[model samples]
Target: MNQLNVCLSPALIPLYNVEDHIVVIIDIFRATSSICYGIENGAEAIIPVSLVEECAAYREKGLDYLLAAERDGKVVEGFDFGNSPFSYTKEKVAGKTVVLTTTNGTHALHLSRAAKKIVIGSFLNLTSMCDWLKLQNDNILLVCAGWKNNFNLEDTLFAGAVVEQLKTGDFKPDDAAIAANDLYQLGKHDLNEYLKKTSHSERLKKLGIEKDIEFCLQVDLITAIPVLDGEMLVKLQ
Candidate 1:
């Protein structure tokens, strides 16, 4: 039987035995959600860079890719897009490659390199990600790319959602998983409304991107599971 665990932030990743677990990176406020949208919309692949310069260098080398870098909840200057689901429409990202860097999400992905497999998780592709997890039969570790190594509500809720879905499986959840499940139980009724008061929600709302928040909370908007293949994330078809 597999077990389910949760790490509220990447800072706590080292506390767990991640090398043998399937790490599902959750950044529901935007990053992972945007990645889900991009892949479902037919983006060729998403290369997650940890630094703005690294993302820009992909373009400097004349590689035909969209440069998406965000810091402090705003799009980094000179990038093609920010970490917003709306920017990844089928018409825009189809057949295109994206080099992505964000404040937390990409960092979490990089830190989780020791995992047996890295799967991107967001509410946008909730069910599909769960399906993939069921097939793996590996211990699950939901890694939340919280706000700069601090805990955040949205990611934990997403983690809780995953745990809630896997409740029937042969799994033993850790304390973090139990906490996340409690959070999910509290917010599962109306995710958008439940998360309205969260810091990240307020941060994006201040920027007038509430639409992205709503879209990010949507369940099963797509059926793609973004998995890290080498250095890039490609849809697990």
Candidate 2:
């Protein structure tokens, strides 16, 4: 049987060996969602770095890449853009490479380098992500890029959404996975409404980006699966 599990936070990442499993990294607030949007909008690739300086270094090298850096729910100073799904439009990001860094998502991506394959997951591409996972034979680990290494609701809910879809497959989910699935079941009906009171949601709302929140919660908006190929993320066609 195929084993499925959820790592609630990156702090628990050391507990698993991503080398042999198919790892799906979830950061629903924006990072992963923005990545999915960017790829689907025709961005060449996204290079995820864990630090703002690293993302800036790409500009120092005179690279033709858009620098997107966010920390504590806001855009980093000097960054060309923030981690907002709406920022990555076809007209702006098409044929451009994006170098991104975020508080939780990019850190999780750096930590998940050992995975056999790393997939970016968010509600925007929920269906496509699950579709890709169903075809893989390896064990599946949903690694939630929880806020600052602490548990967050949005990413956990996304893990559950994926688990709910994989129930018919040969998946044997662990306790954490089961918990996430239950959460998803509860919020799947009205994700935007259910997550409105979440810490991350409230934080983003304070910044007046609720539209991005609504957009990120919409399912199946895109069919692209952003898979990490070495240092950059590319759409898996």
Candidate 3:
């Protein structure tokens, strides 16, 4: 692995000296997409909470919040909204604040407590995330929200997308991204088919969110970069 810092999960990422690497968090299924929508449509800020209770707590702190959460591909109880970009329509969320929680994405944000700087990544902002990474100092870590603390292809594939773009940078792409880039290059001709092979696709199909999968798999439709400053993910200026 060399001096290239890499961690699959925040829970597993050892606490060490990593004040330099760019930490890109990927939740390709939906959370990042929703983040894209919120930032693109002029939402004030999106605070990502690891738990529903956390979101509620933030709302109670006089934030004037819209609570959004999702679990197992469905909305959670006692929340203002769910994890869908469609729900973040400009008409509904523009000029407002949001507290977001998700089964995977927000949890991933919470886990990276030791990251130097955390940025949300998805197909939509693939280029922006990488371009930002290119401008940072040496070393980079791609934290993937593996399904239930296990290896997940979709997250890694998104990481690979970043690696592909940083080919000539002073970055140390993890081996996971190496393999992921291989898969991405091989199936790039029919990305949908490749995405269907991921565990997320199976779960989405079972949850009847095949359409969501389609929406998430749409690449490069947006350039909005959602950056995590503490628990809140806001538009990257």
Question: Could you tell me which 10 consecutive residues in candidate 1 have the lowest summed lDDT?
Answer: 199-208
Whole-model lDDT values for every prediction: 0.89, 0.89, 0.72
Model 3: CA > 4 A from native: 1-6, 15-17
Point out the worst 10-residue segment of candidate 3 by lDDT.
1-10
Q: Give lDDT tens digits, candidate 3, residues 1-237.
A: 223444565466555344555567777777777788787788888877677777778756876788887776677777788887788888988888888786676666666656677777888777777777777665777777776667777777777677788766665555665787776787667767887766556567888877766777777777778777765678888
User: Per lDDT, what order, best first?
Assistant: 1, 2, 3
Q: How far is candidate 2 from the true structure (C-alpha RMSD, Å)?
A: 1.4
Q: Point out the higher-scoring one by TM-score: 2 or 3.
A: 2
- Over 1-237, each residue of candidate 1 has an lDDT whose tens digit, in order, gives 788999999999888888989999998878899999999999999998778998888877887899998776688888898888888999989999999887688778878899999989999899988988988888999999998899999999999999999978888999999999999999999998898888666567778778888889999989998899999899887
Count backbone clashes in candidate 3.
0
Q: Residue by residue across 32-137, what tens digits does model 2's lDDT show? A: 9999999999999998887888888998888798999876657888888888888899988999999988768878887888998999998889888898899887
TM-score of each candidate structure, all chains considered together? 0.95, 0.95, 0.88
Q: Which 10 successive residues of model 2 have the least lDDT summed?
A: 196-205
